[model samples]
Target chain A: MSDPGKSSIPFISLITLFPALLLGTIFGIPHLIGEGSAEDLITLSGIGVTVTVTDLLFVIGLLLSASIMAVVYYVLVSKYKVAVLADSKTEELLKSRDFFLRLFDDSPVPYLMVAKDGEIVLPNKASQRLFQMTAEELMQYKFHELHDDAYFAQSRTIYDKFVRGVASSDVEFEVVRKDGVRRWVRLSALPYRKQGGKGKGGTISLLDITEQKAIDKVKTEFVSLASHQLRTPLSAMKWYGEMVLQGKEPLSEKQRRYVQKIYKGNQRMIELVDLLLSASRLEMGSFHIEITSFDPILIVKDIFEEVTKSIKDKRLHIIENYEGDHTNFFSDKKLVHMILQNLITNAVKYTNDDGTVRVSLTFSPDDLHVEVEDNGLGIPPEQQDKIFSKMFRADNARLKVADGNGLGLYIIKEAVESLGGEVGFTSELNRGTIFTVTIPNATEGSGTKSN
Target chain B: MVLQDTVLVIDDDNELRGVLQEALSDAGFEVLTAENGSVGLTVALESKPNLILLDLVMPVMDGWEFLERLHADAWGKGARVIILTNADDIDSLSRAIEGHGYEYLVKTDWKIDEVVDKIRGELGVQ
Candidate 1:
């Protein structure tokens, strides 16, 4: 491609004329040699015409100079047009660049461009406002500098990955401002390389999410409070039922049955409230972990005793299986109990009369495995994916039992997750469900206790 | 006359207190009732019941303050107190209760008979 701005048209035209001048001199020299003398009159003939050398030469020179000027004129005009087009293109590019720069500077979301080494390169106006510092002041700091020490270590890892040309999106981080106030932000970054893939850099954007976090906390607290408030009335009803049943005078059979129904209804309501409370506590991450060595067999036996009435009501055969040593087990006792209780309850509730429930405990050096298999109404295949979701109940399970609140499985999943464990289930339609849970033993260095 | 172990029931709910009183009296223990934590603390100091069924949330004084005040007295250090709460596993309270190895029960989860049995167990009334 020719650079119209760089090579001048006049210079090119002048060079073209030099070759023509040499040809003209060669033709004139031949005519002068054939004429009478070199200094005398010279005659030239060409193209079936005769003329004196001076007149011919003069006509040729005039024609050559005129055509050269025409060529030069055309070249100059085109070059002028090319130059004008190039100028406008450059101006448009510059305008758009300025517009985008302004947009980046004025955006409410904080924006930052960092170098390959995670050093802050260019911080936009919003970024400066977020940090309450000037771009110049922030330029010397790294991307993770604004985070607290614990978060700083984590942020450094993410920043290092970004510097290695990895992209990250919407990772939540808590950052401290210049005034020592902490706020939550979701940060995203995309890696960019220089032309020819030389140097690596990235653009980062942070969205302030402190308000959203606060609203979430408030919602969790409300759920907790509402559940507690519901429990008081339910408790009163339960005790009242107990008192009437335990009264001195024996009541009629119908009256006793009605009282029992009231008692059971209150009991169901109380269990629902408890599930809601547990779900909310799990959501809020407020539950504590107490690590103690206990026997899994003992826990299972105790749970069986707790549900002995239900077991007898259905005449369901209860089977216990202990695999391996079944001792030296350590985990969060409450969470383990919660997981097992929910599983066993579901097994008892959904199993048909005379159905069998197998409670299996497998112990290893590193983990404990619990399996509760019941010949009960299993979950529908299509809805199995949502079994562990909050407030999700299978179609068959819902039709079978009208009293379940659908939070038992969700609580189990959440509790197991918090204990750094895994839970899964296999079910066949109308046959049964076997829920299997594996919880890792709390090792010496790594316990499930998180405050 | 057979010697009966005295049990104090401290709660803000009148109906709950009455029912618990009846149930504990039927369970063969001398039952004392208080409407709130302050009253319960005074009754506990004066009567020195063998066991105390204390509710955590109440007007005038909560169960935590009552526990604190009760523990400040010399005789109260070894007093057996069973925390009965409608709320589920409050973080700080549960931690403190667990630290002290005190028995904690959710009121709704327990039946009257079960509570009586637990009180019997605590007082070694078998």
Candidate 2:
């Protein structure tokens, strides 16, 4: 705490010297003139007083001393200004430090400051509350050590990355609090460096996702329940319907027609249930992607064969234009099936009598490209934006078909996106619509087997 | 004259079991039926059926446990199974394929004739 104004001492001493010099010049000059006749030196009479050399020297020293005093005063005032500035700056720095500390302490999100070695340097109030421990107890453990044993390996990997100055976001972990309660947390970390300090640390933020994870688990369980419960009865109906159609008793024409209708209606009900299950799984993010090798053309052929009745009824022209020999491509079969099935079904259903529907498959090392084109009722421009929405049908489409659930395109979009692909379309009202799908090939070792 | 291959149809639903029994009988096999996995396993072990059409979800000792118990027996280790269930669960599908080297079919996705064809192909029967 040395004085900030201490540098003004030399200026003060110089100012004091001016008065002494004035006196010395006043008294010493007369002696130097020698006691004979002081009038011999240049003298001026002004204001009826004799102006001697000593008087002239004395006036000059007085003026010099006044200038010195003025210089000293300026230096002192400037020094005071500097001190005031330094004070405000220190106060501003302190206020900012307090603001951030308060934010870290009072924030709803749990935060922990970790040393470079992964030790818990500081745990805020929220983190202490989350772990159900005091700050002192938390400080005794490393950040990753607070996690459950089952997640310890994964947690260590993330912490290792963090210690290497790599930032990570939303890595999930399971942790047990001191009260023996399990919690799921998604943590994000960033490297932190202290101002004018040598050590580098990390600032980790945690979000308690236990409740959200529970909700997701429940949703997934519901999907599974719906799949089992709904499909079991549907299967029973289908088998019974098939048995009646294949019974040994001879049937009248009317009876045959009615049985066929029952069979067909049961089949449609099964499809709707399947569609609803797929949509639910897609929305719940509970669907798994299983990659396998298969002939995409065969898939196309199977779909075509399945819809042959409708194709025949409409007298639609079918064209298969496969560009490359990708008989055994690797990708998620379920997603591919969903994408192609929806597009081909829509094309078939919307196309009119004598209309043309073309299925094309182009394969490359990086992408599998599929296009289904139908020269039939194109989507109206007004409803094009909502084409991929769930249970949405175009006005023309609804008018053309009496029975349409409209979940096809929604499932297609969701499945395609999950597979890291894109589905797009081009259509003109009453002219045509072409739906295109481009999916990336699965990387090697991801697929389970070949068929 | 050759002996007709025997097939076991194990399912929880009674109507489904009856329908499958009739269909498989018509398809020229000695069909045996059980309403759940436990009874089906006992029948399979006793009769040594040529093939088993197993349903995943059942009342007593589900298909997974049945498979495990069957594989532990000497005569049941090589038993052929076609998983016939309406559930399209991927985890169970992969487990059945990779663990037991069995085939999986979503019942709703396949017609009875198609399922019969798969069974015939598995049995090498016309």
lDDT of 2 by residue, A214-247 (tens): 9976876686577678887777778767777777
First chain TM-score in every candidate? Answer: 0.65, 0.58
Angstrom error at residue A246, model 1: 4.8
**Clashing pairs for predicted structure model 1, backbone only:** none
- Model 2 chain A worst lDDT window (10 residues): A36-45
The models' CA-based lDDT, in order, is: 0.84, 0.84
**Cα-based lDDT at residue A263, candidate 1:** 89
The digit string of per-residue lDDT tens for model 2 on B1-126 reads 179999899999887788788888888889998888899989999999999999988887788888888999999999888889876857666665666778888989877888889999898877
Best-matching candidate per TM-score: 1
Q: Is the docking of candidate 1 incorrect, acceptable, medium or high quality?
A: medium
C-alpha lDDT (0 to 100) for residue A253 of candidate 2: 92
Error of 1 at B84 (Å): 2.5
- lDDT per residue (tens digit) for residues A242-355 in model 1: 889988879999999999998888887887888888888988888878788888788778889989999999999998989887667888888898899999999999999999
Q: List the candidate 2 regions with Cα displacement exceeding 4 Å.
A: A1-42, A46-48, A52-58, A64-100, A113-122, A128-183, A189-203, A244-292, A297-451, B1-8, B21-32, B41-52, B64-81, B87-104, B117-126
Poorest 10 consecutive residues of model 1 chain A by lDDT? A36-45
